[model samples]
Target: MRKLALSDEILLKIEKPARYIGNEVNSVIKDKSKVDIRFVMCFPDVYEIGMSHLGIQILYDMFNRREDVWCERVYSPWIDLDKIMREEKLPLFALESQDPIKEFDFLGITIQYEMCYTNILQILDLSGMALKACERKEEDPIVIGGGPCTYNPEPLAEFFDLFYIGEGETVYDELLDTYKENRKAGGTKKDFLEKAAGIEGIYVPSLYTVTYKEDGTIDTFAPSSSHAPAVIKKQVVMDVTDTYYPESPVVPFIKATQDRVVLEIQRGCIRGCRFCQAGMIYRPTRERNVEKLKAYARNMLKSTGHEEISLSSLSSSDYSQLEELVTFLIEEFKEKGINISLPSLRIDAFSLDVMGKVQDIRKSSLTFAPEAGSQRMRNVINKGLTEEDIINGAGQAFEGGWSKVKLYFMLGLPTETKEDMKEIAVLADKVARRYYEIPKEQRNGKCQITASSSFFIPKPFTPFQWARMYTNEEYIARAAIVKHAFQDQLNRKSLKYNWHDAEVTVLEGVFARGDRRTGKVIEEAYRLGCLYDSWTETFDNDKWMQAFENTGIDIGFYNLRERSLDEKFPWDFIDTGVTKEFLIQEWKRAMNGEVTPNCRQRCSGCGVAKWKGGVCVESKN
Candidate 1:
């Protein structure tokens, strides 16, 4: 049995003692002496948040299945425990074995969001590893990065020795095989990375050099060694149905952010929302076989004993066999007391019927992501949902007895106007009015509409990558426009409005479009005690601004300025299978308020089908 790193006394002081304990049911435990490779997979957040992520769970199960490999999990200590660990001089340890992370051969961090940047340094610092990749020697673990943020890894290049640029299902086995072979040959770290770079999707950042123009745009990005591939193509699994699934996952003793069993219905989204990065980067949407998904759902529920199961996808309603899948789960689990949670469904008759069967009227609220206010503005972002559609959906939902509704929108999108912002309030008021239009005797309750908006951040591989963002003050002011409009409604009590932190959104924009030099800003910010920056209480905008000043990199260069169509991007070297020409055409169409049909509706000639087959390959009527 692995010894507990925390003392009984110290464990009593923390908010959630279950987080540090490692004897969770279904967690893998292997003999360290037997395995040749000791891999530590870290999510740079607290235990609950990290445990909730599907990617980490998938990779954890995959890596541990190898006889030669022993993959373990770690997460950043919560601030309370962090202080105690620092004062007691406790090194960061993995959850399964409770062993120091510094002893591991490899440490892989998943970069899910830009806000978690500072937390990366926190993991390294507590583990006694060198925070900078260039400072590490052969004695240190090979630090690698992967996930959605790896799609544009330049901002974090200097901190990570290498980045897995694409889906992990295909290339990780090959990478591990190469690493094992190199170790057997007495190879050095340099030899390992150079060999890893030859893989289809692996990016060795130290082997490349980036040059900047006078205006801080990327002037050139080229290979510094002959071993590096000039272009790293993203790896995709053609058939997701055959990929490994974790029938038994680590069940936390305490409730996690997503406490229920999660069923990933598919990969990628068919809808081509202009500002969405996931839709573009994970193109040509592929789904798991319905029978396979149903079996996995049953196995997962049985192994973990979770009462609720959530269907996870970019858009759950867009799955081709959603109705069939949901009906199957309901029939299989309803008697067993297992509940279903659906996400991002359209307000259509089928959706209303399915939701009515699964959800209780008192406990659940219907979610709609119209993404914009008016039909014209919706077309500008290719949101595809018009005001009439939203109203009609609300009417159906109202008649179906769902009085509570949640609406999502993005502020500071390119070409947004005052009327566009006001329309958000107008839309919320309309939803409430639709509820009253129904007779009081027929209603579940009084109507409540929650309107929430986040500042738009233009990300790579999306149509809005060239779009300029609002300054922190400007974002806050724009959000105020919607809030004030909502206050004007006579039924103000029925509506509740909220917006994201403008300061955090501005910093996220800087990192989203930033190049290699942005690494310096991140390092400086970490040195000045910036950690857990995604948390509202821990984020320090003043310190981040100072880091920019210290590094002499203008913030406006990355975030506030609009780029020319012909300008080169820092992430141009990495191909996500979607062509630049396709994105450019979409950008032009968005400007003209022209809507492109979804993949199932019509093929738009996006280049992804050339690489692998999925939803984009079929002919449309």
Candidate 2:
């Protein structure tokens, strides 16, 4: 049994004691002296949440497969444990060995969202590492940041020594080999970083200098070191089927957010939603073979003893072999009493038929993310979902005994109007009315349509990247339009409406499109106790405002200003396989309400095919 640093007294006091305890089943534990690299994979969130992420598990399995590296997992201790650790002066430790992360060779963090910026700082602080990369000594671990957020990592550049741009599995071996070589040669951290930068997809923030014009727009982002490339291209895994996956993932003693076996059916999305960041960043959809997925799912379920299995993908319905995969699962597991958890399938006739066979319709609410309320607004966002489609889908679902429906929309989108906002209520009412059209004998229960709208955040590498966003007040007013419209409905009692925090949305926009100068504001916010900004209770708008005020940065300049066609963004230095020219063209098309066909329908030529293979093969589904 591994010795725990925290005593039983402290563990018992916290909300989830299992979170702090290590020695979970299937967790990797190796001799520290035998491995060439001692790596700590840090997810800037609670354990249950981090343990649920498939990316971390896949990377953990891949890294551990190499005898040269021993990677352990660490999550930000929950607020309760955070207080206990701070008061007790206990350094953050990895779950596997209960060893201080400060003693590790590298700390790789996954920045999945902009709201988790404060937590990144908190992770560094708790681990006894310097908050800023430049302030760290030669003995400190090389702090690396990755994931979707690294495409525009300038705002937090000062904190991370290196940013891995693109897919996790692409260039890790080369980078790790370089680190090993440097260590064998007794090279310093800087020397290793310089050599690592030479590898593709590695962005050394210190090697580049960013300068801005008087207007606060990025003027020159040039490489200062020879190792730094003029333009760092993102790495893509050409063949995802060949990638490593953890059939026997580390199982937590306590339940996680996604405890079921997650079978990743595919990578990337085909639908070109102009406002979406993931659709753009994860360009050119690629899927696993249906047979392979069945094999993996069964293997994982057997290995982990999970009773349920979920198929994961950006758009599950878009998978060419979705029906085949679902049938396979239903046939293989129905007798065994294993549950088949479906992804966000379209509420179409086919999906409804499939759901009837696999799911309890009363227990599962049909979900549809129209993105925008009105058809015109939907066209602007390139949602490709029409009012007729929604109404028809809802009607078919209701006929199939699904009484509960969840409608997802976005407020404050570009070109949004009062009429457009009101249409959200109209759509929800239409769904309720459609439910009533079904015979009472066939109905599952009373119709319940839950509509949720999140504030539109213009993110980098999207058609809306150059678009202007709304203030918190403006966003609320737009949401109020929908709220009032819903209240006016005769079936208002059946409808429930919810909106996300506008203040948090505005802050996310500021950080998403911000430059290197924004790093100071983030640091100051962390200093003012702004950790876990993603959590509603911990997010203090006043402290964030104060940080912006203290840093002398106009939040509006980053969030509200509309950039010109020729303007350069801080993230322009990194080529994410998508050309700026293409994005600009798409933006213009969106302004004209022109819908671009999906990757399968017709090739829009967004330029992700440069790597060759995958879904960009013209004839690929």
List the candidate 2 regions with Cα displacement exceeding 4 Å: 611-615, 618-621
Q: Please state the error at residue 112 of candidate 2 in Å.
A: 0.7
Per-residue lDDT of candidate 1, residues 1-621 (tens digit): 568989999999999989988889989999999999999999999999999998999999999999999999999999899989999999999989999998999999999999899899889889987888889878789999999999899989988989998788998999999999999999999999999999989999999988878867778899999999889998887688999778898899898999989999888888899999999998768889999999999899989999999999998888889999999989988998888998867779999999899989777898998888777889999988878889999899989889899999899988999999998898899888888889989998778999999989999999999999888889989999999999998778899999999999988999999988888888899888888899988888899989999999888888888899989998999988889999999999999999999888887888887754443543332
Off by over 4 Å in 1: 612-615, 618-621
TM-score of 2: 0.98
- Against the reference, the lDDT scores of all candidates come to 0.90, 0.89
Clashes of 1: 0
Clash count for each candidate, listed in order shown = 0, 0
Alpha-carbon error at 33 in model 1, in Å? 0.9
Residue 445 CA error for candidate 1 (Å)? 2.1
- Pairs that collide, model 1: none
